[model samples]
Target: MNHDRSHALFTRASELLPGGVNSPVRAFKSVGGEPFFAQRAQGPYLFDVDGNRYIDYVGSWGPMIAGHAHPQVLDAVARTMRDGLSFGVPNPLEVTMAEAITSIVPSCEMVRMVNSGTEATLSAIRVARGATGRSRIVKFEGCYHGHGDSFLVKAGSGALTFGLPNSPGVPKALADLTLTLPYNDFEAATALFDEVGIDIAGLIIEPIVGNANCILPREGYLQHLRELCTRHGALLIFDEVMTGFRVALGGAQQRYGIAPDLSTFGKIIGGGMPVGAFGGRRDLMRQVAPSGPIYQAGTLSGNPVAMAAGLATLELIQAQGFHDALEASTHALCGGLEAAAREAGVAFHTTRAPGMFGLYFREGPVESFADALGSDAAKFGRFFHAMLERGVYLAPSAFEAGFMSSAHSEADIAATVDAARAAFAVVAAA
Candidate 1:
């Protein structure tokens, strides 16, 4: 529970890094505390510089599906790095990665690897615009597709956590081109497409809406979007960075049984390494460089080390009942937390999809951005610190989703529920 070393590190970091963290939410500004500096991570626990260990649910923002520092992933990295870090040319591992992605998600006939989710999304949008010869793109409120200029408008995650959904530097011109829609609202989508379908190049969405605290698509909602896009000639892009391989082997698209025109992937695809990819039907992907007119390039796009690590993780997850077990863990964790909240007489709800979940300080049925926003952020902030104090780490911001890993066991869940039992009492008292 002592964060003395962590505090000292933050003091030094504050002088160098903006907000004392590389990522915005890590500052814990929304949660009302300083962030803990991790010394090491093993299995499902994060060890801080103060030597305090925690049951980590952030899972490196959704990539550590197997767990932190899994031997398989580490060994893959060690072996791959021995050859060289970057080749400035094609590597066999990259080919293996591409094949793995395309095979797992059949919708991606061809995929382009990128350095980060932001890059993958930006490139996908460009492809959308270029392929269709249209100007506007559609994104939903409370859905974040990385920090690209086109995606910053009405964004989620850190933007929502800090109450700045629209960042300042994004130009008004660019903002105008990025249209926003309410998530899980079928009528709004139909109306918007009717109004601007001609000018719309693509409609990008996080089918699972992880940034908005894990809002699942309403029944048949994804099909409606697919139909609209098909009729209007606007490509449908699934930004599955967090959900890809985490929600299911084929991701949310697979779970939901929808095939998008374009798909962007990150997180688990890189297995905790910095990597991303976007692909879809061959004809559309063929338009992106070295094949057609549109150009997108990265010197370290398919870094061998990253590819090897990701491939290894993918192999582990492919084991029989991997996702089934992960899904059960999510249900168990959420059910226990809800029970603890009920016992404490605190209003609470949780939304889950396979390995990812959301915690809300409100009632159930959180199906839209507004519903997620209605959760009491202030109350959740208090609970966050209380849980952290008891050796459990949740996402720093209430707006971000929590992730579960294969490394987590029944004992870990029991200990977490025990922590929450006390934490919820703290919330009830507050």
Candidate 2:
């Protein structure tokens, strides 16, 4: 592929933006390549600055469930744009969006809108502290709930990609408020609660764990955590930013049959636009500013364009058989890839949960971040470039999950498996 345009663009971006990209992951630092600046995306395909087309599996990191530039969502945004964009004040769209969120996500009886996932997680943590009158919170090591100071103590995603799972700018005092433990470790979670359960304001986690490559909760783990949180009187906060509408319409709460006190949402809801939200029990949500003592504000909190896009996106996903079809496609891709890897003499273990999946170059199950790390990164990186050369796109890092959108059909899955088969051959031969 001709990367002349992408290479030049990266150089220009580095001179202007931090790390040559708006987001760290988009830099392609882990894969050692010039980031391909996207020209446009439609129907699960990304066209790059060089005009190379790729079958996109990242799906803008778990949004675009219905596909990029989906007509319904785009039309909503276009229609709303005619009304002007921001109004540093309330709008009917905001109210309607909140209602849509609450209707679909049962845990969110009341929710507050924010501009990004970071703000949503930060606000949720503050609300927890204010409502419980406590100072500390508990989060899993591999769970990425955006880049809030509390969430960054040992976040996944960008932090993991940079090899700095624990960032430096976060003060030790503030970091002290967050207790990070290995994900999917029930004993450790229980042990922490036993030692400092009384001091924990709340517990936050990505119930399906997309950040560490879709590591799922071990047998009844979520249910146990919910019960423990209740016993200790700490609120359970589910950071469903990646899984909200993609994993299931109601998210991990619906999939695992667990209800959290507070939940954060992003991605699919925005329909490829920028938006984030946090909501849960009506009483707890009432604690946020204008409702109670906790203070949180955003100038662009409920931008009409984003609201219209999100509402339209949510409505599309809520349509009949949306998730069922998405899930079936995801299973075909993940399952076929696993078989292909095995046939190619690759020591690979794969796992899937609804619309999300993890592909590990290992022999056994990946239950935690440490387990995920045991895989061969050098080989996986090689395989990534090989696949990219074949016009198939994956997440930049091995530690991130791959998303499947409703736009991905059986033909897309079949073509992806063919690409994976060829890529695996290259790595296995090397």
Candidate 3:
């Protein structure tokens, strides 16, 4: 496929934007190529500037559950835009959004909106510290909670894609306070909490580790964390930015039957718009600014446009069988791809949770960050390019998870599996 226009755009962008892209993974650095610029997206496909069409599996990094350019979401945003854009003041839609979220996720008695996942997570951490009067926070390795300063330690997503889990600018003092632990390891977490349980303010986790390629928690793992936090006087904060509505209507918490003390949401909550939120028990959320002592404010927190889009998206996902269909489609796609890899004699494996899934160029189950890294990166890069050439666009980096949309049809899955069959052959030869 000719990417002449995309190449020219990247050339200009490189001189203007760092790495010629707003996001690091979009640069395709880990996959050994320049990125393709998206001209437009509709349903389950992306049309690039070069006129190449691809069946999209990234789903705009897990927010397009209802799929791109859904008429309902677009109509809602358009209608809201006719009134005004940013009010910088309270709006009814904001209240509706808060109500909708709280109604869906019982753990969130109240919520505060922000512009991005990073803000939601950072603010959540602040609230935890303020409410508990503690200085230390715990996060898991390969579980990304956005790029907040405290979270950059052993973070996943773009940080892991570029081989820099610990960024340079974070101060040692701040980094020292952010404790890192392994996911799915109960003994280590138990031991750590026993040692410094008092100093730790909260434990933040992805619940389902999408950033490290969709690693699910082991049986009873989340319950263990909940128990430990309760015993340690630490808040359990679930970062559901990627999994919120995509995984299930109520998210991983509902699926696992565990309720956290606090939760952060983004991605699907915005319906492809820029939005984020942090919320929890009424008593804990009451501590946030204007309500109590803890301070957290945003100039455009409840922007009308974002709220409209989010509300519409949430409404659509709530329809009966929405999540069930999405989960089945994802399972079908992953299963087909695994069969293709087997036929091609490629050492490959995959994992899935509802609408989210992961592909690895390794054998057997990938349970942790170390296991994910053990997959052959070189093989993944080859397969990524091979699939891209065949009109199937997977996530640009191997470390990232792939998402499915309700808009994806069985025909799309069949076409994708056919492409994967050819791609796996190329990867096996490589």
Candidate 1 root-mean-square deviation in Å: 2.9
Model 2 CA lDDT for position 65: 86
- At residue 316, give the lDDT of candidate 2: 86
Per-residue lDDT value at 45 in model 1: 99
Clashing pairs in 1: none
User: Per-residue CA lDDT of candidate 1, range 1-430, in tens?
Assistant: 7889999999999999999999898999998989999999999999999999999999999999999999999999998898889999999998999999999999999999999999999999999999999988888888998888888875433211212237879887788788888898888889888888999999999999989888999899999999999999999999999999989999999999999999999989888999999999999999989898999999999999999989999999999999999999999999999999999999999999999999999998899999999999999999999999999999988889999999999999999999999999999998
Off by over 4 Å in 1: 155-165
Question: RMSDs, each prediction?
Answer: 2.9, 3.0, 2.9
Itemize residue pairs with steric clashes in candidate 3: none
Candidate 1 TM-score, C-alpha based: 0.97
Query: Can you tell me which runs of candidate 2 are displaced by over 4 Å?
Result: 155-165
Candidate 3 TM-score, true structure as reference:
0.97
Q: What stretches of model 3 exceed 4 Å from their correct place?
A: 155-165
Model 2: per-residue Cα lDDT at residue 245:
78
Task: Score residue 273 of candidate 1 by CA lDDT.
Answer: 93
Candidate 1 or 2, higher TM-score?
1
lDDT of 2 by residue, 1-430 (tens): 9889999988898999999998998887887777788999998899998999999999998888888899998899999999898888899999999989999888889999998888889899899999999988888866888877777765333211212226878776787677777787787778878888898899999988787777988988999889889999999999999888778889989988899999998887777788899999999988788868799998999888999999998888888998888888888998899999988999988878878899889987888888888988888899989999999999999889999888888888899999999999998999
TM-scores, one per candidate: 0.97, 0.96, 0.97
